[model samples]
Target: MLFHFMSPLALSNSYFLAFRPREEKSQPRLSTPRFSSQRTLFLTENNQKKLPFFQARHHWMEDYKYLFKVVLVGNAGVGKTCLVRKFTQGIFPPGQSATIGVDFMIKTVKVGNDKIKLQIWDTAGQERFRSITQSYYRSAHAIVLVYDVSCQPSFDCLPEWLGEIESYANRRVLKILVGNKVDKGDEREVPERIGRDFSDVNHFDYFLETSALDATNVDQLFEQVATRLTNDMKITDERVHQYRADATNSSSNQGGPIKLIDRAQTQLNSCCSRQ
Candidate 1:
């Protein structure tokens, strides 16, 4: 099934060659590699970095050490898809169509030495898709609530979104309030101070303004998501480790059946002496 789906793109050149007639001199074929062109550095024991040319292969499969689910919920036209596209593909999708139900994308980023994969779910903001989108809230590690800076109604409807999040999401889920399209300076409706106040009063974990069009703080936004979640997960893991260690120490210190027998014998001896 997987091969069937991938065969078209894999055999496209062969299909084109079969249709063309044989010629005396065939033009040189130009092939473009699918992977990134960036060079990977491999350090040696001498602390020297090895840079090899034409090293297009990536070690992403082995480097991906963590996976996190992040969901975006906001009004329909608030640029959620555009933000995800800009972050994942580095392109501003002008005139992007409204999302129907839900869309998802995966992008890997480095948080310290650990490679963190962010599974971003872009939920449709339409009223009809509320049922479908709400189902995703419970499984998300972080929920980003986005609003348009130029739309007052979008900002005003934040309470409704928050209510839905509270009802459907986990209690410990990280919540972030994002004011998007901040580049529209003249047409801005929600002031940054007001947005901050709203986020503070509502207990959002963090707040920021971003522009998917200008690529302003777009990278920072996702980086913050990955960093915050990575730190939080690390802290949680440490606490669990400490708890397990404490539990083990406690169990080892507690006397087993032998101590219970010794206590019972001591009580019998005391009764016999009193008699």
Candidate 2:
């Protein structure tokens, strides 16, 4: 699962690690730690305890706080492959062939001391693969819709892609629009303003212009995805924690159901006041 691919800028390697999807049947539970004379534990930013640095390698594989599935979709030859390659492998695949059905990669990134594992799916853009790609949308935590800046047809077909996304993706999935091939300077057909405008009109969570060839804004694109998803998940975790606390307190007062509504209303009011 390791390959050496050469780009004009440098020689780099891309790794396609063999990944097994984490089981969803049971959630991982953190238990109170028991101190041992032979072992030491360190606290993460979120106060999760872990093995000390020297013995953490084995634990690191499962150390992530969250796992996000990020799928890239757009028309064929739009450089979706290149963008993923550049960010994960630091290589601009020269004359890269169109992705067949799907290319998958795994990368672990840190968002403010929390480890986030990104499961990246680089999907084919050909019409023939449309059915297959749509299946991935529903389970994705985020979707990146890419277009080539030099290709007008690719830009024009965005609506078709958006339609497919709307039909298949989760309603709350993070949506990102990326305009690739910014290296095609003079040949650019899609202006930055036009891309931003489309993103706004279509309610994209974020928009970015990137040049996989030169690595412009390439890393930033995926970093933003991780940061946004992590933040959103943290907020959700907080609400769940609040609900549990309220339920526990309610049982003591025999006001279980009513307290839940009151807690939710208080949270809503607090959010509105902040806004």
Candidate 3:
């Protein structure tokens, strides 16, 4: 599995909470909820009102640095839905059923100091939805191919998934290999080494073994996706800026002599006409 060898970076940012759980009992019960056009007002014991953390910066909530579309594709019953729910909503759904067509969700996470909005597309694994799911790959910035560690058939189907991704997704798209259900240790079918080897041979960007049921590496999985994509985009933006700067500089440098020549030519014409 690929391990992040860089120095630790600030990856997660928690929202400011209005009240701490421990302080809730000591404070007087909130009463007569008041509202303002710009803030949410809640009255205190002395009749003074205060704004909640979120209410203070409600407009800033919509601001983000970038938006990336991440699509999850894997065989049926590989806990793809569970992974998305756990990462976005912090829930491991019980008795989860196979997806029908495709489910879409939006989540904003902080990477370093920039806010990134991820448009997660959880595609169904059934054959009927193959056409629909394939349509999503072309636009995806990242594609996470998941498999069940306890199911050999799911692990075996990875090559087929890779083929589809290569045919439909962007060539530079971030490809991640995930072995789900590591919590199923006793019933494990695919070895970790084998999965890692597959990921390496197939030139996947990253690989990890995650257990969505237990919330193992769930946050890390998505965090890596956000961080990697953000870094790539920043690099691209820098290159574009540099290219524009270079072009502008070249045009300005070339214009100096050309303008001088034009002015000299105009002066010569005036002199000749005067003579």
- The TM-score values for the models, in the order shown, are 0.71, 0.74, 0.72
lDDT of 2 by residue, 82-148 (tens): 8888888889888999887776666789999978877688888999878778877866778999999
> Scored by CA lDDT, what does every candidate get?
0.69, 0.71, 0.70
Candidate 1 residue pairs in clash (backbone atoms < 3 Å) = none
C-alpha RMSD values across all candidates: 18.7, 10.9, 17.1
lDDT of 3 by residue, 143-220 (tens): 999999999999999999999999987676789999999999999999999999999999999999999999999999
Best by lDDT: 2
Native-referenced Cα lDDT, model 2: 0.71
Residue 41 lDDT (model 2): 22
- Candidate 1 ranges beyond 4 A from true positions: 1-62, 255-275
Write out the backbone clash pairs for model 3.
none
Best by TM-score: 2
